[model samples]
Target: MGIPLSPRPARVIDLETMRQRQQARKRLIRLAPELDGLEMVYHLPSESDAYYGMPLLAWGLREDGEVVGLVPWMERLTPCQSLEDPEHGHFIGYRDPETEELFEDPPDHKVTELEQAAAYFEYEATEEPTLIQQLPETQGTHALCMDDSGEPWQLKQVFGWRLYSDGAVEALLADERLIDSTPILPGDACLYPGHSRHRVVYFFQRQIANRIRREDPATLEALALMVMPADQEG
Candidate 1:
């Protein structure tokens, strides 16, 4: 008779904690070269902590009591109903295992409760929204960045006088440059779709203004027209 095959043991891993730590470590490693010989301090939230439906890790690069950089990593989470008022709607929050703190930040601003409810139901109602919708859209006023080859680097969405990245429901509070620049309006959408990519390392057009602003999309498109492959020229 054939020997019975033993069932493989299930890998019991805390994925949220693992992801948060990985991102935190990655950010530190990337910035290590920039710190040179200076010792940089990190101020990350205790692990497994959630903030506003996302797992978060905060680190401040400091020396001699002054901060040079602040990096915060937020991980996505599974969808869940709102605890405050279930009849009002449902949402999601990041889950971290290293820490016991849960995020308690507000979810919407300026946008009405009904509007937020609509978004929660239409987009985040299910476990995941359709992939195409999940992809960032380059509509309304935005910050834009382009590579030497003229490809879009990223898009920063603007609402009212405030700007936001696609799917970023709340404004990013840690990036100083983004906070300093004059907020863009909907009419400015065609102006700065991927500009922030030029300043921060590994910046992309689809990313939000988590660091600094760079250039406008129209300018990038013009540059591309002058240098891009003839087949790509429009």
Candidate 2:
């Protein structure tokens, strides 16, 4: 069965908020058993790289039903409403697990007062909205990724995944056609929609930055502004 992506309301609070987040993440790890074999991508920026614009946290699942991630820091995975919230980082479009396509809004669903009260433990139940409701609307954004030759490929969506918690929404995207032709390694660039100006983001890696710095210091210097740090609370 496909795992549900929506956060479950916690009515009982036996643990602290930090522990709750950790336990929630751990529960997700258990749910996604397929995630065990897949590579765990990281973003460890070096001293030469600029700190600005680097991603502080990110999480996502692959179309094949495995979790794929790139993380550099884990500190910023604090519970928040939406992954699109500026506090999290640039919003990589959320992929619908069933249809495997990008989407703008959360799934249509409503929470009843009893459900909210039974699920919420952090605070008194005040008609808490579903976790997916916190996501930003992206109807206008066009999701695209760059290939080795700098060509853009549109991403397809997979639906059925639902948001269960506040912080663990998946917005990272991947394309099989693009990956087959040219694997996206660290330093590869992709367009990040939603920003007013042209914003290019790269999965930051220390070794890749070193290599780029050797071949073209100027390019690396400029790309420093667009590095997306792989950050996870896990």
Candidate 3:
């Protein structure tokens, strides 16, 4: 007799899997809120803080809702002395999800004077107080660099983006790519751009630095911002 062929594995869709997926979708929809009438502000995390020192974008939610803030990951330039020749100056930028305050040690690890000047020039050319007021009550602030001892430093400045929202803060946390060890809570701030429903949160992590090196050393730095469940605070 001919040997019987093994039965092919059945294509299956489990109820639990279906339910979980549906719940996730519903959560996302529930997170979006009407943010047209609330005042919003964006500020870079303080350099003195133990985390979030890289160029980050944070949004403060002023409207009454479950979602209070949103933040997104971003990269910035850092000035450095050429490894081959200390006298000759070269610059590089990194994306770090951890707090910028963490770099307060080994002052040599920080950005260069040229990078600092560039950041200032960019800020001055872009900031508009009147246009900011016209937005549905929106505000923003520049990023501050800190010294080795976690004290505020004036040399390397930073900036961030901001937005207001009516949805649940959990919605912003949906992106697995943005989630890091840093704890994101309901009270944390978030930034959402106009005409976009998904908002991003900025954070600092050492892995982000590694990512910068891997992505682009000369021009661009790509980093991941992760979101963790509120119950499992980092």
Candidate 4:
């Protein structure tokens, strides 16, 4: 009698799958599941807030970081909201399909600001460009520091770069009128420069503006980047 050989067993690959597991989380998906391998994140523009167009896209990760359960996602079964009557329901299939009764009721004011803001932003972005009128760069506020030891120079505020919290200088350098260009927050700051560069001779408001003394150490480095330097201008 001869012994028969068996084929290798099939391997079960483990994939961290992220899916909408519950009704509450259907709109707000988990964030950054790929760090743990949850890659099966399904998303679309519609899953986001109906008013603003911000993508509500994220991965739904499990405690163990694997796709193991089904929760409350109705996107596949019930898509699109009904606009037949604002009072009745905004999300169509969420309500009784036949009678148009809602599965849940949301306040009337919830959607107003989200919708209006989205529309306003779209208009500002897509509409015609706004040209900044400015006078000569030399005429604007001049500022500079020769070095760590040199006297800090300062004048009226310029219409060029404004030092932001994130160490960025957003340049809107072509206009006679000076404007405020500071970022609202550290994250809101620009990562790089704009179209133009203005070599400023800045006078420090304070007597000392050293790296250790200044609030934002990167400010000096950021301003230095915009300069062509007398040596590099040629």
Worst 10 residues of 2 by lDDT: 28-37
For residue 14, what is the lDDT in candidate 3?
98
Model 4: per-residue Cα lDDT over 1-234, one tens digit each: 988989899987544333423322333111121121111122244445442111111222222322221111211111122122242223322222234343332223323433443335332222443321111112122233232223342222223333222212233222224323553222232321232333333332222234324546576565456333522542
How far off is residue 204 in model 1, in Å? 13
Quickly count the clashes in candidate 1: 30
TM-score of each: 0.20, 0.22, 0.18, 0.17
Best by lDDT: 2
Better of 1 and 2 by TM-score: 2
- The global Cα lDDT (0 to 1) of model 4 is 0.28
Model 4 residue runs over 4 Å out of place are 1-118, 124-128, 131-231
Q: Per-candidate RMSD vs. true structure? A: 17.9, 19.3, 21.9, 21.4
* Model 2 C-alpha lDDT versus the unseen true structure: 0.31
lDDT of 1: 0.29
- The reply for model 3, stretches above 4 Å from the true place, is 1-13, 16-22, 30-50, 53-68, 74-234
**Residue 87 CA error for candidate 1 (Å)?**
40
Q: How many clashes show up in model 2? A: 28
